[model samples]
Structure formats: C-alpha cells, structure tokens
Target: MDRLTPLSKPDPVVTLDEVKANLRITHSEEDVLLARLIASATASLDGRDGALGRALMPQRWRLERDQFCYGIEMPLPPLLSVQAVRYLDAAGIEWDLDLTDVVIVGTDPAVLRARTIWPTVLAEPGAVAIEFTAGYLQVPEPIRTAIIRSVGSLYVNREAAAGAAALDFSGLDPYRQWAFG
Candidate 1:
C-alpha cells in the first residue's frame, strides 16, 4: 500500500480580503465567518483531498511505500523538489539514499527515477519514504477565480438546499491531474 502525508500545508490560496472583495462585502461583522469560509474553500480544492488531485500552494509531503523500485510516482504535483529518499534497512534502521542516485521526472504526478539499483530494505510496510515539495509558487488565475466563486456560492446559499448553490466548475477542468495524463 502507498501512503502520502502532508509534512506541511500551504498558506490559504485566497485571503480573507480577496474573498470579501469578490463578494463585495464592505462590513467587518462577518469577518470571522468569511475567514472560516476562506479556509473551507481552500481545503476543498488545495491538496490531496482536493478535487484537482494537486496542490495549489507550495507544500511539503512525505510519500511512503513498501519497497523501492526503479521508479516511484510522486503524487500532488507541480513537484518543486525532493528533500530526501529514505528506507528502513533489514535491521529496522532508517537510512537516507544518496540524492545523486535519483532524478525527478515531470511535474504533475512526478516520477522519481533511480539512476542506480535500489538499496536493500526490510520486508515490511512503508519501508521506503520520499520527502518532497509540490505545488505552484504562483497559483494560476483560473484556480483563484474558482475558489472565489465557490466561496461566493457557499456564502450566498448558506440557508438554502445544496443544489441551490450550484457552481459551474468548468473553469477548473484543466487543473485536474487526470486531464493532463
């Protein structure tokens, strides 16, 4: 089984001020609610649990696997860099693989290609781990628009039925990882 853990999360993609401006909100009475809504909007589209299957802001993640292979697929991309590749030795001791031994291939759904043979590891679950950063340093405009529109819909229909706030998310189709590969 493969497991992905967020080592650190990115700052909110859209700020409270930005959301407020989008909604034309001029009062501070709903600042707290708007802040929460901003977080909610970012969470709905930011990282692994996000619909896009990619990170919107730069963030760190650790991906673990049972064993090392010639190549490993890194999820949540727009991969920025790989910090380290590690494995648990047969004796249950953690060891870091040489950085020069591997290469990062592609951006979205980046692949880690081993330049040499993989090291031996214990026969156990999550014996190999790769720490890396993925996401955009500057988020695309369409994504920002989507988040703003989503927050607007959520704010406007807070009391109505679910379908009442129907949002046309056709603008976000291009960002979905599946759309690229």
Candidate 2:
C-alpha cells in the first residue's frame, strides 16, 4: 500500500489580518473566530489532501512504498528538495540511502532517480520510504485570494444554503489538479 504523510504542518498561507481586511472586520472581538476561519480555509485547499492536490506552504512529507520502481514520481508539484531515502532490509533492519546515490529531476512532475542500483528492500508492504520537502516558498496570489473568498463565504453564510452562500472556486481552476486514468 502506498502512503503519504506530512511530517510538519504548514503555516497558514493567509494571515488573520488579510482575512479580516477581506471581510472588512476591524474589531478584535472576532479575531479568534477569524483566525479559525483562516485556518479552515487554508486547510481546505492546502497539501496532499487538499483540493489543489498540492502544497501551498513549504512543508515536509514522507512517501512510503513497497518497492522502488524504475523511478519514483514526487506526486506533489513544486518540490523543493529531497531530504532522505530509507529502506528496510530482509532482516527488517533500516538503512538510510546515501543522498549522493540519488538525484531529483524535472519540474512539472518532479521525479527521484537513483544514480546507482537501488539497495535490496524487504519484500513486504512499506519497505521503502522517501522524505522530502515540497510546496511554494511564496504561495501564488490567486491561491491566497481563493482562500480569502472561501472564508468570506463561510462567515457571511452561517446557515447552509443551496446557492446564495456557495464558495467561489473559479479562481482556483488553473491551479487545481485533474487526474485521468
């Protein structure tokens, strides 16, 4: 089974002040509420589980696999760096692959390539793991705008609505990932 886990949480891409300004909320009375909304908005569209299927802020991730194929595709785009690769031997001993033994290639769909033959891995589930950092050092302006708009929609419409309070995601179309079989 393939699994992806976040090693660290990404800080909110949209600040409380920014959300407040977008909502024209000047009072500190709702600062706490606004902060929560900002976090929710950002989480809804950030990282692997996000709608964008991408990381918005710089964050670390671990990808676990049963075996190393010819090359491993770093699913998250805008990959910043590959930190480490590790595998378990047949005897269940963990070994760290030397960073010099692998290289990162490409941009749109970053890939991890082994410079040498891959070390033997245990023939079992999750025997190999790769740790890397991915995401934007600076999130795109449109992404930030989308989050703000989502928060605004949620704030203004506390009650469920059929359409009047729907969150607008038109700004996110260009950034959203569409997978095809």
Candidate 3:
C-alpha cells in the first residue's frame, strides 16, 4: 500500500483525462458515494494512520462524467475473503465492470515505497475491471485463472431489512439467486 502525507478524503480535483471510469460510472453522485463508502472504507483499514486520513479526505472534490481515467490509493487485505467481496459488491448500487473500483490515497512515504501493497494483492474481479488514477487495471490474468478453480463468490441476505437500516439495493438480484435461475 503506497503512502503519502496523511489526509482525509475530498482528494484534489482530477481532470477527466486523469480518471479512467472503468465501470462507466458517469455520475458525480456515484463518484461521491464511491469516495466515501468504498475508498474511505478501504483507506480506513489501510496502514498509515492519522495523517493519511486527512489527505484521503481533502474536504473537497470535482467530478466530470464526461471524463474518466485510472490510478488511486486504497487499503485492501491479503487474505481477502470472497464473502467480503460479495458483501461489498452487494453494497454497491451496481457494479458496472467485472471488477471493483478501489480508491487509494495516503500520507505515508513507506506505503508509497512498498507500492505493491494493496494493488499488489489485488484479487481477480471476474469480468470486472478495477479502475483508478495509477491506471485501470484488470484483475491480472493469473489471479482470475486461479480463483476460477476455487469455491464461489456469492452473497445471501436472509434477514429482512428495516427502514434507515434498509439499503436501496432492491434493483439487483443476488449473484447466486440469478445464477440458480
């Protein structure tokens, strides 16, 4: 996991040419949601503490659905479980690409030097393509081939969801549910 001057999100504005928009996520609202929920979540767990928080949430942002690019910072664990991915995916409004979009930004020099941290452990996204500032990276072929030989990546929500506590994921069916059909 690359590190930088610790900072909270609201990362500086990146021109459209700077982003790759891997999943065709064209709405600024989507970007905002991703930044806070996904990126912020990942960053929270990533190494570097206090400082990295500030930079990651820079207090502001600018978006352009008319543009897209890749490369960014995020925190991801190695022994990443399939269920974790599934839960995260389920949380998403809709996963456009076969992969998940991870945002990485930190304020630790050591992290940047390691470079191979989160991105290095990047797991296969099936057909999904993870995109960011560094570049829109597809789950390296080797990983996909390997995971294919593994068990499965499916999510199930047995309990009923309540108000406020309820998620607006009514549009998407469970990956397993659709598969069984």
User: Every model's Cα RMSD, please?
Assistant: 2.2, 2.2, 20.9
Q: Please, what are the lDDT tens digits per residue for candidate 2 over residues 41-87? A: 77777877777878888899999999988778886677899888999
- The alpha-carbon deviation from the true structure for residue 61 of candidate 2, after best TM-score superposition, in angstroms, is 1.0
Clashes of each: 0, 0, 49
* Deviation from native of the Cα of residue 48 in model 3, angstroms: 3.4
Ranking by TM-score: 1, 2, 3
Worst 10 residues of 2 by lDDT: 158-167
Candidate 2 vs. true structure, TM-score: 0.91
lDDT of 1 by residue, 1-181 (tens): 7888999969888888998898999999999987877777777777878878898999999888999877787788799999999999999999999999898888876788888788889999999999999899999999988888887888887776773344445678888876321
Each prediction's whole-model lDDT (CA): 0.84, 0.82, 0.24
Expressed as tens digits, the lDDT of each residue in 57-140 for candidate 3 is 222111112112243222221111111111113333323422333323342210111223222222323322222222112323
Please report how far candidate 3 places residue 165 from its true position, in Å.
Answer: 17
Better candidate by lDDT, 1 or 3: 1
- Model 2, position 166, has a per-residue lDDT of 51
lDDT of 2: 0.82
TM-score for each prediction? Answer: 0.92, 0.91, 0.19
